[model samples]
Target: MYISLNEILKNSIFKSVTILAGEAGLNRKVKRISVFDCPCNKDILNRNTLINGDLFITCLEQFQDNKDGIYDYINALIMTKSSGLLIVTDDCIDTITKDIIKICDESDFPLILIKEDVPYAVIMDTVNQYIAIENLNAINTLKLDKIMYGSVSNNEKMEILYSINPNIGQYLRTIYVDGGFDSAIEELKTHILYLNSRDDIFVRSNNYYIFILSADDIKYLKHHSDATALKVKEFINNPKVGYSRIYSRKDISKALEEGKRSLETAKTMNMSFQEYNPLSVMQLLVSVKDTQEAHDFYEAYVNAIRDNVSAENLKEILLTMEIYVANSGDYKATGKIMNQHENTIRYRVNKVKGALNMETDNIKFNETIAIAVKLRILMNEIFY
Candidate 1:
């Protein structure tokens, strides 16, 4: 971000400077600083030499009592789109007139009054430093953008990372944010800077903002998972977010794909965010369509339950089966998930077996039942 007049006002050298007018334009970016000394030379205000966003500092010595001359000068600065004007009074000019302040206020142009005791050299030095820093930040942002999404080779990526942070280690998580207003995106960036101690890098790709975090940082976030998730949901302005599993920089491309898939899942389920999981059978099955083959598979295995069980009981039994399979057939774990006793879990398992007419003890039959349960759930979602 470029330095603004508000930032300049915060400097110690400008602490005594009073804003004569144009409070609305304090946020105007100052690209460069120029000393306006030639009061008689109107040609100096030409667009070729004096560009927009230039901050002008002047003493108005030549136009000491010529109010019209001063008015003409201020008008020229406004026409050239100068960011702001700082006038050193008590040197050659006594004070700015109400007419000048009126013009500035109407134009929404920044007008600052500096005491004559404040030397112009100090203002020049401070503003130049700010400009230099801004230029460096812009260059770094460009490099980061190329590294994240451009067609840079692996060797180039390594070199860029080394240049940015020589001690850069593995990036463990990729956070992808999709769909938000530009202002919301800016707010999210500000929040990320606050949370990551301003060490995180951000880049825009298509419709998403991608953030890569180190393993230790990811661990810290997971440790404060509840608070972090709440902060994200609150600050991101309702964007769909996807978080990928741990991965090294070498696998960034794959990690990004995982994040995209997770985002798709979150959008389908109307969730604000989702973490990628490699072992989620429901997530995998949800990708299947209600085709003839899938319907046939579901019927062949789950027909008895679908035909005989009530709708509410069918939902409960399928949910129980899903938890059972997800927990590797650990009935106690499934019971905890279902908020029931182990005996109740056993009763449900027996009901499922009787309905399917299959032996639960047979490993092959159990596997088939798991697959059938997943397909049946997916079909319900598709058709219902």
Candidate 2:
């Protein structure tokens, strides 16, 4: 993204500069800065030299006595759609002619006057640095966006993954936060930068922010994650936090899936945070989709429950199983937590069992229902 010309004027470095003409074009976006020092004779070269949104700055020393040369330069700038022109004036290049400024006004182009005392280096550095930072932010966020949406090429995707951490076979983990206001989200990003020793791959995807940390980055962070949670609590009364299981970047899609499931699991269990277990029975069911049979097994269960019931009952079954699994299959504990009676909780469990024709031991029942509930929760959290 390009920063506007008006923003540059407010950068404090351009305090002495005067807007002699072309004030109407202050909102023009600038992507780069160039010097308009090329000989006025190279009309063809100058026209082709500048890219769109490039702002040119010069003293016009070579064209000091050539009125025609000055006019040619301005015409070239206008033709190339330059952001603006900054002319440094002194005794040698005392003034810009009325004709030049008049032409600029007609085109709604910006004409800035920098005092001779200011060096060209100052203007170039400030504007280029600002543009570079904005471009970097674009690249950083866009790469993650492509991966999240599954649109990136394999080579480009590997470049992004390996860029975060180059060590071989090391597991990368993603820490995700769900749902925060705009201000709170920005605050969370700034807080993370302040808290971490070095920058990690931080990106805002949709309404949530994700920090994909290297294994090394997570070393002291497991401890600091508590501190991180406190920062979250400041914005969210009871934040839902989820971090993915250790996985290679090759399995990032699965990692993202489980990270989302982790938070949904947290919300369902009435917990503040959840670290998804790769060994989770539900994880196995989700993973089964990677192969035809596991795919069939997982969907067979999820579709059976989701399709047979009304939306209201499906909602109830999910909550009931979530509570049932969370309480370790203890009916009384689940009831007490839900503020419902033990018989009521049992009836809900039986209602789900009836949906699936489940006839099994308690351990089997716990694992199966746990998988079903998580798959549903994950289904809700999936985003493009």
Candidate 3:
């Protein structure tokens, strides 16, 4: 029996009661004891620290003092993996003791209160009986820690949706469209719409128009691309289940850039009409998937490229590009931000293209990759 008596006066009242209890064959089975909330004494350590059947006692005065020592004793019990009883009693239950009680509540530490007329022998017998029965309500709760660990699986996807607003992350609607790839696009739209018709999802696809109930649904659909591709290659899956070879985040980011560019160009032309911008799409994206998709994409992409690319190299380009793109290729400001000669920055840009294996001096490709990098950071916020 490894019992800890954390009483302020364990020396006087506590020890006398314990000795009497032991004489009455109450603590006869006791192996170790801990004395908490007592004044420190090095002599006490040498005399009372038991090795085997000898009674071992540790005195901890303050809550912080008890923490490490108590944790060690608990961990020792856990390591041994034994069915043991831990008893904690104090003369005055202060904030520290209250906190200790909270820990006990959370941890399922077997607790017994010392009350008037409750003989120590009876208490000891009761504890022995409880131990024999192996009361494990706390152990059951401990098992829940494992169950609560890690990320949610595909089965949990719908759990998240319904956990929020039942109708929020999904929608059901129909629309018409007229434009290029009309028939193929219509089929794709119809397919998405049909998929969304289920309670799990919602879709609206027609001609040049496309709409989805939830961003999560779109992400899920996009993830299915790899699965769809595998199924098609192995089983000759039909167009109804065709998979696009597009990474969802990449495609979304590109579309966002296109939208922003369109809006900016519209502004240049003094046009009232405009499409969505990257920032607007970002807002919409957050509203739907709430960053989960972005995080997943970032983690995957970063892990994929980290082996080949140095973070420093990417950072350098990003820093220089900030000024260059801001000033619309103005060398002076770009160089100033980089703290390098304008020519040096140009040289570095050329070097970046070489490193990335970009041909024909395609700055658009560089820009695309830059956007991808930024998207990675955005995705990390959602995923990992």
Candidate 4:
């Protein structure tokens, strides 16, 4: 829910700052900023001076007389579970020694040095503002989350949602990413595809990035899924994504469920992304996998069609059949992909259909076999 030091240090204001040590602990969350104006010593670093998750910003004036006080300060930071230290160097203490950097690295306490010219007010403003906005987004996301996933009445949910985005139309859509992160709320904020004007709600829950986009924003993605997917992968590292169809506010639970189920389907199918369709063949493929149902369906459709098949040509025949089905029953294209003659592919396609006592011309035949082909793959009927 809090912004990590790693996130804040990315600001342009911190670009001039040097990260001296403890690069590994950059993900530590910053709950507050502590500016050290008072003398820093063991007595001052006691429990009363700081709490957990405090990031200390100091001028290093206190340590000018005894610069090794940096060691005691760092040890105190580790003991109290503080976030890290940002030292603004002055004339008296213009740089940190290697020994202190080693201590910071060993203790996993971030040590930073900044120019004395960079105003503390600017640093505090930049870091604290990031903290504030991130905290606010987290709060709003949680509130809407309760209204969405919790058992709140429809009127109340609508009212709260209206408060956040007055233009929240009849429809809302969700995108779920399996990329877990601490400060994902900013993902919605920073992405070019998402607009602050749109009031998108993003949150990290159960190690997944869940965000709800308004119907207006869904316009960009409804039919341009590939483009949207490319953009998501561009930013999100090709994560396993399940995006829901546009649905009403009352269908929030169903929308989230569709996203979850579609993501599951993508994982089971070894795909990077899936868009949920209630009547999709993928939906049917996912539904019947529990217990002995997959085996039963495979036996009735795939194995039945698979009967009288030779063990030697089984791999080729199954591969050709899969290509044919994926190409929408186009034997010619399937042949091109398989680098075989169209006649050969058509014969293999008919041989499978003829065994099932069906013809290629029937509309439902393609749908039926599509399910069977996917089920065959899902059940691992063939070695490949």
Top candidate on TM-score is 4
Where is model 4 more than 4 Å wrong at Cα?
41-49, 159-279, 283-307, 336-343, 350-365, 375-383
Q: Which lDDT tens digits does candidate 1 get at residues 83-174?
A: 99888765654546888889999999998888747778888987877676556556655666666688989888778756644554455456
Sorting all predicted structures by TM-score, with the top scorer first, yields: 4, 2, 1, 3
Q: Residues 129-210, candidate 4, lDDT per residue (tens digit)?
A: 7677667667666765677578888777777767656765456777777753333334634532333545455555545766
Deviation in angstroms for 306 in model 4?
Answer: 6.2
Candidate 3 residue lDDT tens string, 1-384: 132222211322233332211122222233333333344344434564423322222213343434445544433432332222323343322322454444444543333333233344544443333332222222322222222342555345334434322543332211112123223223333444434453322212221222222234555654442343233223221212211122232132233234334433333334433333345543244333335665564455444434444776655655565466556667777898778899988876565555555646687645644454455433333321
Q: Which residue pairs overlap in candidate 4's backbone?
A: none
The model with the greater TM-score, 1 or 4, is 4
TM-score of each: 0.51, 0.51, 0.24, 0.71
Residue ranges of candidate 3 with Cα displaced over 4 Å: 1-315, 322-328, 361-363, 380-384
Per-residue accuracy of model 2 over 289-353 as CA lDDT, tens digit each: 34555445456765677776777676666777787887888999999999999999998887677
Each candidate structure's count of clashing pairs:
0, 2, 7, 0
* Prediction 3 global C-alpha lDDT: 0.37
How does each model score on lDDT? 0.70, 0.68, 0.37, 0.71
lDDT of 1: 0.70
Residue 319 displacement in candidate 1 (angstroms) = 19
* Per-model RMSD to reference: 9.6, 8.8, 21.8, 5.4
Ordered list by lDDT, greatest first = 4, 1, 2, 3
